[model samples]
Target: MASDTNELFPIPAYCKTIVGSEDGTIEDSPLQKLEISNPARILQLCEGLTDRTTKKLEIKINKYLQAETDASSVFMINLLTVSEEAMVQVVGDNILETSIRTPLSEDTISDIVEYKDNSLKCAEKLDPKLQTLINEIVTKDTGDLNIVPIVAKERRANIPKKTIVSPVYLVCFVNSSKDNRYITTLVHETFKYCLALLLNTRECEEERRLKQQCQSLLAVARKLFSHLGDLNDLLKEIMSEARRLTNAERCSLFLLDPDHMHLVAKVFDGMSPAEKNTEVRIAKDQGIAGHVAATGTILNIKNAYKHPLFYKGIDEATGFKTRNILCFPIRDEDTIVGVAQLCNKMDGHFDYFDEQVANAFSIYCGISIMHSLVYKRIQDAQARSQLSNELMMYHMQVSDQDVADVVTCPNSHDLPNFESFSFVPRRVFHRETPCFVLEMFERLDLIDHFRIKRDTLARFILYARKGYRDVPYHNWQHAFSVAHFAFLCLRNFQLVEKGYLSKLEALAYLISCLCHDIDHRGTTNAFQQQSNSVLASLYSSEGSVMERHHLSQTICTLNTEGCNFLESLSREDYIKCLDLIKNMILATDLAIHYKLHSRQLAMAQEGFTRSNPEHRYYLCSLLMTCADLSDQTKDWPETKKVAQLIYTEFFMQGDLERKMGKQPVDMMNREKASIPDHQLEFLTECCICIFRILSTIFPSAKTLVDSITRNIIAWESSKNVFDKLRVEGCTSYDVLISEELERQVQATLECMQDP
Candidate 1:
């Protein structure tokens, strides 16, 4: 009866039998399967065990085995329910004579207890160590086998009501046997699957974490690339991001100070704010960061204390203990601009990944740093330029005492009528030229009407006088004379009353006259351009070299603290005044004079009015030109004196030109000059035309034209006598007939003068 029962329920082919030895050893027997007399019925039963069901069962078995405390024992338990009753069985070499059975109505615990009792009985025949481990597992509660509870629930859901069902868990035991290697292999293989599943889950989580870290790195890179600020702020942000990215406890960003060939710590995140600013500099070949900067290489050191190139001075100074270091160079193009040094990592020592991230971040750091450095340099240069301008203004400022002297000087009430042909400014004002200017301002009521500050006006006049170079013709005296001529035009022509010029225009005209030739170098525009002087280079493109320089110098003088007389004007009025002054002064350029004169003549033909800006500009230019050459319209003695002074200036320029290997023009060359002939040409071509245009504008200015015409006649007579003397073999006019010519010219001038 026993042989018949064993053949009917043979062990499955997948099951292996463990044979026990007498010396407490267990060995694996050959696999065998029970013969099914009805092969078709066995195949039908196997079809019910699908791959999904088998996988779930395997997972449950592995979970239970892993939960067991004993490493030597593996358990495989299968629970089957048939006809409202459940059967529990352990799949192994040993099998109970009767399967543990319980009613479906009763709890599954009864079936599990019955199975444990049967498993203990079978374990007694195995090796002592294996038997002991099984006994412990069966007797003890071993806590609830909660592993794969979801799989248990899933299997329970699949069971049909009132039908046979089986839930299987396989367990294996490895005993202390010399020939139990196969059993040990089975045990290890089962646990290896569980470990692999656990490892796979952990790897997914690690992958997610790495992706997040990469995103963070990308964000940091974007911010660093777009960073636009000063160097200090940028460096601090870079170091902070580097520390956070690499999980470093401390970070230092050092810039290569190319000037000193040293590494300077621009930012030290580990240091306190007070200590951060402390100067930290290292030679380019000295330390780790310096080495990186010098060599442009990345250094990942596991232990900074162990590295020979590690710099410990900063650590000592800051009370920071650095365990590891990751240093890399920051590069702009091919040049290394700085280095980033990361100290001990928070979690572990710096690794290759950290080094790679630092290397990538340094690229953006270098660009940001380079941009910040360039920006800082630009700001510094602008500050220096502003400071230089301020210093220039400071030096050019007029003193308070000089201003006080001019303001306090007695006003000359007995000033000559500047509009008269015989008006001599040098004879009238004498040494009190500035005083006469003040009286003119007072006579025009400009000091009150324009809200001019007395001290500022006085300072302006004194500074204007001082601004003139000690040239032969275009000096302080000449400036004063031109100003007097402008004043004469203002007073005599009724320009302001007749609405030909506004009060502001009149004031600008006078101021322009005073400052037009403030810093004359006794050289013409052509001479300045030919010599390529500083003034010419500055204003040559604008077409009025000396005139523009004079205007610039005038602006500089007015900018002086005590000499800014026009400061009282409203913003609009001030701008208009400056514009008028610019136009009036620039018109003094002879190159511009003909254009202005033509424009004025056209405007005069079209009925010019002060309300028209173009007409006003044309008139202002004409007035400035007329005043500039007013000496030509003076009496013969004054005209003759001016001509001599002008010739002296021309001769000096000619000498300079000859020394520079340049040919002097006819008027400028002393050796080639005929004074009388040059004077005749100047009066006809320049002076007479200027007076003729002015006479057309202001009919009262005809007297100026008449005076200039009479001077031209006097020059013509002198030229005739000079020609006669030259033909008569008189080699020199000074030695022969000079007295006679002087007497003749003096009689002609005395008759022409207003008596």
Candidate 2:
């Protein structure tokens, strides 16, 4: 039987059996031969036919009857009238009497009663279980209501008395209570049943709709993933999709505060031109939307004003009305990732349908929010990396060698123009190790230069004499490497080349490296004034503290050497290498970034001017800077050491500044070590700078540069992660690397020095 209700319509299923024919085939219908079926006779047939069996009879009656009634209602007439009239013709006049007057036997009645009694007993036993099963099936669907079957009992005169009675279910109205108004009960049950059927259909449709939405979302996700590079675009896509799915007239997404208790709106749709900068903030527990957000649940309000939790103050301030709201908390697992609100549903009211739609969307919202957040982070990180690299390249460009390519010496260019300059015969400087030059300076008379050698340069030399134990390649090693590498360039130019070796040239390169750190201090340019370092006053901020130190150190190394490299060189060669080394060492300060960039551009314009002594000096200066940053291109173990050394130098400087009540320099002033990932990121940029510069000046070194770059990437792969709370973790620079370990390292060096 088809159930009918206001909100839902049920379509009838075909009945399995015919009403009267024993064969249950329409060809055997008695009504086929019926001549005049009077209205009264039709009414009788209608009453005789089971109300539950209509679709089949309709088909049968439509075949045999020519009635004024609609084809569907034509089957409502009495079946007996059709049967009797047709039977009378076949069996003579006796059929009428037999059909009308035949009495049912008591035994037959008794058997019917017995069967009914047994059926009722079993049905009664199954009803509760059946209801339970129905409830289970509908529990997940919010629209489902409890539906109970209608059961009736029948008794016959010949039936034997029994404990159980036969019960028949009419499958009529779902009754809320025994006293439910009969008409309303019928309506409610029929309506409820119809709704259940409709719901099944609706669910199928809804699933299809949701599946399509998911496909769309997945497509958007795939597109955004491809733009892994453009995070801003990715975030924009996510916000746009959120608005589209909610059918919201306007929507906005907020970033959670670091504390996670409040939300700060970051992006929006449907904002007035004037409201672009407007901030919307709500507490975790504030309104219908906020409650859903706070509890990580869905909140649907058909009428926002009627809800106790709805606050109108925000609407008043923002000039946006809240009519209907569908909100769901965006969650990544048990953690609430964010809260999303779809306000003023385009349909004007939030319903069960809205809930289903929103619930489906919430899943995408949560994932999209997570994905977008990650995308933005990666974008920010990459931008920072690019900027750092650009700066490093800029520095490489301005090295001393770079300057020589553009600007000739004040008077040296006029000294001599030979077919080929008589290049100096070279002597190897610091044969055992580059640090030997510092020891050689131990015998210099620094008093002539108005300096106390023992207090300054000699102290530095003494420190280096403590011995080299493979300290990681950090700033200190970078400085030492630069010194050694400068020597290599000088030796290569002077000794390796045919007729290239020159005494003057060798002195120029060796002395340049030796005096590179004469007045060295363990701080950056910014800290010089704050710590009242002597170099700060001496240089008067004309140049970086480190650069000033390098020049001073070179001048002092001169007072000690038996033959000054400066005196040995021709005036032209002397000025060229001197200018070259000065600019190269200065590039290490990182403060002269603009200067470095300008010089590199000049070098580029000059093309391959390596054969020019001045140009060779320019290139040599650049090579030294490269060596200083070489750790960035080193193997993991070597790079790790450099990171440690750089960190230590930064911390030592930061400590001094902090003690003096100044801001700590860069990342070092913090009270913890920096995360390895960030450190590795820093190294990666450094590598790019080295590789880029080498590609330009010393293309032969590309293989070596590439190896270092590979190691940095590998180190990043095995990075160490630290909790924000763990103070000792390597996410900051101030974290101490155990005093005992430092002492042991120093002790090891002392033993080596004694032997």
Candidate 3:
């Protein structure tokens, strides 16, 4: 049976001579020599061969030289050597040897490579002889053997066509004895390995492609943020970049509503604006995008329809069918703000590659959006600063002159006793009146109303020096301007006898203006109320933020300092002062703005006509109101500054209202046209109102009013110019209060020194 099989397995050309070496000997039967050019050729030959011949070839090659033979037989042994199987053993052994490894050093390399394949690990046992052999083999550059394994598989593939050639290929490295099972596998096992290799190669290519796409997406996202002007531009750029990188049919971005629990589709592509109008809503954990957002993780869906949570409503509405989705959450550091999703990938269904790309995209989007928000905040803060500076110059200009002059008063006697007033308490007797009033005025800086007759003369200098650090609009400067205006109005009222001053009314106007906005935080009353801040809680949210706390702080500071101003007052006068202060401070609230303006207008229409106490009292109240908004009569820079502060307060209130889930009033609505227009309209009204009031009260104010009117008109002309043109809009930080404004606002200490 063996002889018949040998005849049936025709001897290959290279094997014929080796079989002829010995006569009539079983070993003389040509030890099948399978010679191939390379490892790849081995795969081809294995495909054509049968199962049984491959085994016989392995046995014949092994017996060619059972022990060291003559040099004459060297060619026979080399030709018959089917060592392709050894390459597999080498690879397998290498995997194991390196698997249980230490660092690769010169000493370790030799032992690791040349060690015998006895199936024993380094931990089990050590053969000194085998270890020594391994050292020498690794150290020496044994030529040909290093290149020997490349041909091993080839030789196995080249067996004679007559023999039942198996698919298995034997591979061996000539130099090392580390791997002994050269060609051990049958054809079936080889096929399995090839399949696995194909799968692994495909995965590697996919991983590389995914990484490249991710890198590209990130680059585009960063560029978009640096130039984004508003939320609309931001969303558009995001959508464009996402589609570009993913090569998808469509891409969408959804932001978490301010409540932060639901996703609202803010931007999308391949959809009409009308359809996109109603933002898509989903729970944080709802769909693939929502799931990613809720968990702040990457989500990969191979089939959208297969997903239980893939809301089909989106498909029906957009008339777009989605098969696969790659979604990732956009996070601002640790907080998930929104999610991004890509649909209908251009290539094969979205997989791990798409997931990786989406993740990278999300990172860039998150970082850029955060930077834009911060930039916007900085711009707002800068605008507020400039506004404060303008107010400062206006305040200083008015404070330096005589308040009686600016308001156009005819009398010189009742003008505040500027020459006799002393800020310091020189004697115990002086502390009760002059000393006390001076001290409050110094802290508040209310001396500005007396100086500037020109409508261009601004007030509110304290705000410029202090800026928006501790307080918002209500600061030392605002308090001072209010007091000065109040005092002048008080004197004018008494002169006209529109109302009576018993000592109480005089002191009350002074006190109220000084303390109205003390300890302000440059934010808003609503902020205090919404935050339920300690100030709000302590005052019981009973009135506006500053107005509510003004009285309490004034009383506390007065009591703590133990000023004697009230000691001389009769009970009636003291009560009257308290009442006046409370009423004036409460009037600062915008909620009562219309009423206050109407009453002031009514008094102005009454004319500087009557010389009675009742008429004088009405004039006093009217003048106080004028002083509150006197910024309009200030110089260009100062007036603009005051206006800016008021605007900031308004915008900040809008922001707070939005955050608290309340609808914004007027320009505060979450729409584009509402903000700047609202600001301009209100400011224009104020300019007209202030101009009219000043014209009525101070006849000399005509030139000042004309100048102010020109500036106001100039602002209207540009639509971009600030009431004061430092750089134009508060947004332009390049321009600031002119050097002249700065110098004018820095009042001479000499004037304040006496009172």
Candidate 4:
């Protein structure tokens, strides 16, 4: 029997089994007795019983006992007789009991049972009594059977109470044998161990399911946010996603209109297109959504109609019933941008878990709406830019007659000494500058080399002239003067011979010069940024607002009808020419001159070569800058005339700035401007440095440097005369530049001349 116990039962090495005496007195089994008395001690002993141990016990019992048995014999009777007569009598009896006690505590079991019963009644569409008594016979704490009454109360009652009873047993067996009691304890311990294993398995499964749900929600949100569409479509998708996430029948998205202190319903699901498009605005202080948006608080109302803050007007207007609502604030950073409202959850009512999911979804909603708004704004800006370009083309259109007039004009090869420092463009062109520009193109034979039409060149030139605004300094006249200087440089500097510029490069440079100052507002880049003008917003990051605007206008003009002069060039030449044109025009911005001039000067010292594209472009930019500021390199009379015109444009901007409640800079304010002093500073800092750098690369330009030096001397002499007049109480610029002083300045300039 001892060998059979070791082989069949296989009790663990750590466990000791006690055999009761026939007389029912086992004095040496203290631990066994304690386990019988304390159910918790039984749990500790049963902790080590794995599935292998339980199976072994089951096999051993099945070998000794009958396979079929009554509940009383299996659960209550504790002793099994191994005699042949007892075995033959109970052979085919089922030994394993079908009934088992749950592992939950008595109070927890009572709560669950009551909830189950109420749920079943609700499912059956039956209203159970408010208080119902369920009588049950259960084992007491002392292991004694007792009759207890359990009462089930209303589920939603504020103070609903339940009376709990321990688990009930259906059958019982009376046995005075101590061996039977010990066997009963062993069977109960095994049952407790199995129950604990089942509970742990269930808990693990539930945790895994919850994790999967969270991951699924996040994946859905990622897919929704990845959608790039207009704002209205994005809003509709967001509302649809919100409804899906919360299992809500309907959803609406309300945007906070801070400007008007209103919460506007921007998107509402479960509505026709016409109804959704209807604008519905509610005060920020009213309605559940309004409250959430204003306070940035989440509201999960189980019964929205019962809440005082719930506004019923929306439901009435939409012809829909509102039962429950989950309203969450949509926040961008710390600011509440909007609100998302979900109504009538499919599952009885919204719970805390629904609130959590809605809150998470709202975060994605806020980000998506922000991106959509930005996308819409970009589309609107693009539309406006296209419209502006169309308007520009419309007003600046060059008629065929205008083109024919300029193209048919008699071409003259003896135009003027356009490269001379004393040459005056206003007198040389004789107010027919467009015709002279066409003659220059004809002289260069550009029309035949590029296969360009005479009408196209004429139209482009005329359109470019018209592109310049009526500003005093940066107007059509200034544009023509710059283009003229570029032409003179290309013609006389032997640029092609020195490998500095090709004919194509000269054409791009001249065109870039003509279009460099188009549509000038007479205000500086600093003024544009300070005022936050539209041009500033568009081009401030590139650091040359007006220059970029000029480039844009140039492209728009070239795209106009009959103005695309480069259309006949090969694809490669067209692309290269356009790139050179863009670079040259942008280079005219004085803000970048110091860097470009320094780079070119260093390259020139290293023996500049046009083979390197970078070095060639640097020289091109340098030439464009010099042409832009060519007024400072002219004779004294031409220099003074250009200076007065520039100062007039500056003073006009200064007066406008004052009207706009901004203080003008010292150079712009007419009251503070000293003409001779300003001219001296510009000559020393800007004009002289430019020409000096150019002379290093092209020694032929040294004459232009000498011309700028002589002009500087004239400005110095004029400053001295002005200082003397100021000391003599002449306050006005007109009084300071008296006839005597002018004649003196002229005499000094004549003496300093190259002749």
Q: Specify the highest-TM-score model's number.
A: 4
Residues 511-628, candidate 4, lDDT per residue (tens digit)?
8988998888898998999888877766764588889889988998898887899998889999999899889988988878876767877887887887898888888988998999
Worst 10 residues of 3 by lDDT: 70-79
State which candidate, 1 or 3, has the greater TM-score.
Answer: 1
Model 4 CA deviation exceeding 4 Å by range: 1-396, 411-413, 419-421, 725-741, 751-755
Model 3 segments beyond 4 Å from truth? Answer: 1-211, 218-222, 225-231, 257-264, 274-288, 346-348, 390-755
Stronger candidate by lDDT (1 vs 3): 1
Error of 4 at 714 (Å): 0.7
lDDT by residue for model 3 (398-420), tens:
23343223334343322243322
How many residue pairs clash in each candidate at the backbone level?
A: 8, 41, 44, 6
The per-model lDDT (C-alpha) reads 0.68, 0.45, 0.49, 0.67
Better of 2 and 3 by TM-score: 3
- Model 1 local distance difference test score: 0.68
Put down candidate 2 lDDT per residue, 353-428, tens digits, no spaces. Answer: 4566566655665565666667666754564456335434532222333223222323322112111112111112
Window of ten residues with lowest summed lDDT in model 4: 79-88
| TM-score for each of the candidates | 0.48, 0.33, 0.34, 0.55
Q: What does candidate 1's lDDT look like per residue over 215-296, in tens digits?
A: 9877886776555545666777898899899888888888888888999874578677887767678899887877887788
Model 1 misplacement above 4 A: 1-399, 416-421, 724-738, 747-755
On the 0 to 100 scale, the lDDT of residue 618 in model 1 is 81
